[model samples]
Target: MITGGTTVNGTGVFCACYIRQSRKKANKSEASPEDQRDKTKGYSDNEGHHFVDFYEDIGKSGYDPDAERKGFDRMMNDARAGRINMIVVHYASRFSRQNVNIVLMQVLELFQLGVRIVSVNEGEFTSNNVMDLMNIIMRFEAGHNESRNKSIAVRGTFEKARERGGWLGGLAPFGFEAYKAFVDGVEIQLLRPRKDESKVIKWCWETIKRHKDDTIKQGQRHPGSLAGLVHQMHVDKVPTRGARVGGAWKDALWEVTTLNRILRDPRIAGYMAEPYGNGKKAAYRIQRNADGTPKKYGYDPILEPAEWWELQAWLDSRGRGRGLTRGESLLSALRNPEDEPVLNCACDKSMCAYYGGGTSPSPLYRCNFRNVPGHNGNNTMVQHHLDEYVARRIFARISTAEEDGDTAGFLLEATKRFARTQEAPSNARERAQLVTERHEAAQHLKECEEDYKSVKDKGPATRRAVLEEMDAAETRLKTLDDALKALAAADAPALPIQQWINSEEGNGDPMGEGSWWATATLASKRRFVTLFVDRIVVYKSAMRGNRWVQYDASKRVSITFAGEGETEEASEAA
Candidate 1:
């Protein structure tokens, strides 16, 4: 192939070879980065172009155009800097397998700058001729179709593996180790409890359990406050479970959030969860069987299901007790409207609830910021009235949701759709299959359109056949397009708030099941209030129509509270 000092043909052509192989569950046996680089370099050498550099992204997908692929970014930078005249790859698919229009746009960007692309397998792709460019796009479309097919196939493989209790390979979670075992004479990887790591996991649970008991007996701190346990672990010098296999053990201090995550995970209760998608699109949901019980994958249990549920109870109870200040609020886990952090003043700072002062006695939320120099007025509102108003609104939303029957079914369907996307074809072979189908369908439609455009006065039967074929092909393309869109719009985990609303049996009104807001404990009320209400702007009027006259009993008070992203959160969570 491209040996040392082999190129001398294309005098002014500086070629940068691009190579990519997605890292998501890919094996070294499949088109390794080195092989791609070598093959691309050889093509450049044979073409007699100056092989300037190799731009490579190992284990990165070609589907996401905005993904931070280092090599791809560098290649673009070099092209912008005029460091290279030609971009070479084993195939144009190596450049991208995203939407055809998107890939064409990127190619046009370089084309405008006088840079050429060389797909070793397909030859040069240039905008020099309209026909040549269309041909190049056709080749790219084929690659795109292949990419989708491969993605579908990969997802199917994972789904099959999961169903058959296969490991579905990934990094072992906190107290577990991924081990290979022979099952029916075929080796399969699965998670097993690591003795040392398991001890740490047990310690976390045991410590919380002990605290739970202490709280029940003494009526003090709750077991869910994990920051103390985190501190204790640090004091005990417990090593963090970073990377288990071929990864160094870290001295990282554990956090309450980590404890929160661990306690919440169904895996701790001897279950398996398969993670799919990435970033904001990611959802690490429990893989369940048809019976709604968590699916098993040879995962060793860290805690009994009952104990795990108990742990979750403790974790969810954090920041919900007596003597909690406005600043110390719980904004997670609870579904009751009373648990949201809703108390705020017109000044934007948190309003402190205070008892009555001198003359007119009433419980009030006083704007603490009014004491500051720049602002004026002792802006205060009756806490009971504001709380009632906010609570009513929350219940109304819940009631509306209830009126829209079978929200659970809709949500379940959405979740299922999301799960499918998560399992989208991830490997080259499967991706090739999916994308190839689309490309063929696309090509068939392209041909039909071309034929339609080029048609002359022909026999009625032949013309009718062409028209029917074109309509069929168009329908097939639309179906494929819809499927791709479904894959791209991955589902997020259903938010707890929506789940709670669905679970509750309510009359779809404020005073119905939503009446729990009235009887909720102060701590729980504060927690719920924060979820939607931001601030209650209080205004005091001294007179009815005319004036700034001194008034006490005659003073009129009006309160308006802002809804702090409850709707947005509900939409996202759902």
Candidate 2:
């Protein structure tokens, strides 16, 4: 029997036995999930605790938070709601191997709720004992350290494998197959070209290379766009590689993203590389040898490097950086209801927004899908007057002092009332950390740039080294910037209206919320439009002459507000 004030002669105490296995492959050990479950059950039975439920997470990492683990989430919810008096895990690590902050927060919450935690191997954790709490934290730290060490080891092993030209074990790209080979009496995974699939890949490359110049000349017919080469391939019934499961393949359709990957992949040029980072910060380039040339692998080259690079250049030139951005006048929010995105062209393609070529230079949205078969009709719209009309309606919807002064005051009061109800120190710390890290990254990035600029008459090798360092610093700064943005998104607390407006630093206005809607940045207004407006549908009037004219009152457009689904119609004045 436990000596703490809490009762442990558990006749009525509900015990939630939790078990976790980090991998599908099981080792034959006493701590194995099955053995752990049996031991926990037996212990609960011996202690006379009422076994209410078992939460088992198989093939799930211990370090993942509750949101990622279904069983663990349900168990925590039950404990929080007082549905269970105690939680029993095979060991402390099974509860959590996360970093101290995350693990301690969950444990402290349970302790505060008068819930007991027990480990089958280590015994119960009594809330009143500081030593028990420290021991629990120490055990969790051990687990966390083990996980970190294992991760480092895995990365090192992978790096060595990369050096050896061995496959790092992921889904093979379209035209390749992962196969096992014995090299130096050790079995290693290697990628070899798939015969039937390789032919399709070669054709895609050849066709793309042949059309590269044409694509550059007329950006709309480019292979990078959906309605361009991808659509053409779909029409021609070109067989693309499919997903493989259990040594079986299923038919998959071609997509521009996948096709772009094939075109950009250096592996098709008989090289192997590894991806680093995630999202827009990700980098993938040719792996290099000691002599500074690309490392060659066993796979056969499907396309020449020169043609592959040319195709890549064409694709890069057509990207968003080279074109008219969304901030341009008159092209905002225009939509075609039949498109997959509904905001693009009817052919489910991006429309090139530009000023008209002739004297007037009015804003126009031109769909490049004219080159696509069955989509040869002109998909153009004049947007000169549409911009002002949309702006008027959107401005009306924005919370202004004139429209909802009372509601804004009420919201302020409500937020103040609820301000003290939930204060997350962890969130505050995380935000502060992000802010500090962002500043440091910016400072370091500036220093790197200065260093690069200051270097004079340097050797090619020295200059290259400095450039690489600058590039690394820039990449790190970008990563930190992304993280800060993400943190801000997650921590948008409902502060008072005045506080919300003044959150933007360096503003002189003491009470800016009154005029915030008007003075808001274009990016902010764009976000507001996205939130409040569902879609803007544009239509053309019957042409008086053979050629279509600029915007006039006859050209109809409708702005549909989001929640209420109310649509307001407007037209350009003749």
Candidate 3:
């Protein structure tokens, strides 16, 4: 059980703080996020308890602290490892508001296990006191009260912004900037156009419509109504409202967020939020699952139905049956004759047969799902002709750009290359060593637990030995696991990487090195391309003598082929 004291008699009491601020900071100011964080650091110093880490979700709205997964994960990790003997925060809501009962249970348990909590702005929570219990309850109540205040403040901000023009706390469209109204008024938005970006944006919608019209004329397929209107912002990639970093353009995909910003603005659409904020009706998500899953399509439609439909029609058209994009083309189907083998079939378990001229005509790699009987996926016979393509396309450019100054082509190619790679691990070895150490410490936690039982049952200086031994073991184990997991993942196959290198069509000019090609290794190059262009739909027939072959009419094989009809190209001559 926990004891009320200034200090605990334990050496490994891990200390952490959760830092948050309600105000948004777009620039450097005394009241900005950085300043607020510094304040917490100073406060921790004054309290005499050394906090080894902090969870900073500054500028992240306070009403829904649970949405900050990073903060939650760190807090949970602290609890599970028994490292945290204390959780410090400016206020209780700084941790969580919505799930008070659950959050309190977690924090209170940490106190019982010799951990303590202190809200620097609120008060210290000691398990023995009735005051601490009251403080927790009051803090939780304050969190909800604060939420109510924030909603009112937001409504007022929107009301004022709509009437007088200001920046409300909402995101802006892709090609716009949210500026403060007047010199120091509410936030407002201004149209920030890209270099011919507006024209291109509209043209993207037009291009889709044209493609759909052609399909309809061919009687090949029926197109959706909103075929041409592509959303500037969508679910997959909500545009970040800031300057582009590195060489990336546009920041994120055009999505509903972008569209909504455009439609809601009275500045661009010739009205403001003031009218709507004071209006009787309000909009909320129509369909939320009892368990919280949201239905995809949600619209509060400020604009007329006709205008919204036009936008939808534009989007539906662009997504019309796009035959596996150039990047997604398959190897057996790819037509370049100037490549070598890179990918091996999981079917054969090796590249010995398909490569090295064992087969007269190149054989595509087939999955052994059916043949092997128990594989991750069904026995999908996707083919791969990866002898040369991977080397030339995916990893080749990294070589050329590094050796020679071919920056333009390199970036474009690199984007396609990078799209295939997986997101990096949350805790890389170099980072968060404590997290790994704690996890390791946890593995051996059972050992300490046994020793702890021995001290209680067998009775006795032995306490130090048990606790110290368990702590050391757990820390070491975590470090080792972290090191192993940090090793870069083996390059895997991608649908686009294969198609890009294998096809004669899009394999941009020779990988130019001023003197010689040196950036990438033969193995790296091969692995890179094949990983992207994973599966190829192979349509083949038994060949006789390499001169000609009779057509097999029975087998109409179409794995991923999206075109209306298949044609016999000279490249695929049997």
Best by TM-score: 2
Q: Which stretches of candidate 3 lie over 4 Å from their true place?
A: 1-14, 22-33, 59-62, 152-198, 201-574
lDDT of 1 by residue, 4-89 (tens): 43332445888889988877445853466777888889988887877788888887888766677999988887777777878988
- Models 1 onward score TM values of 0.47, 0.48, 0.36
lDDT of 1: 0.59
lDDT string, candidate 2, 383-457, tens digits: 545455565554443435336654454333333223323436776566555654454455456655766776757
The global C-alpha lDDT for each of the candidates, from Candidate 1 onward, is: 0.59, 0.62, 0.43
Candidate 1 lDDT for residue 40: 89
True-vs-predicted CA distance for residue 533, candidate 2, Å: 42
Rank by TM-score, highest first: 2, 1, 3
- The TM-score of candidate 2 is 0.48
lDDT of 3 by residue, 469-521 (tens): 66666666666666544432233223343333333333344333421122444
User: Candidate 3 at 257: error in angstroms?
Assistant: 15
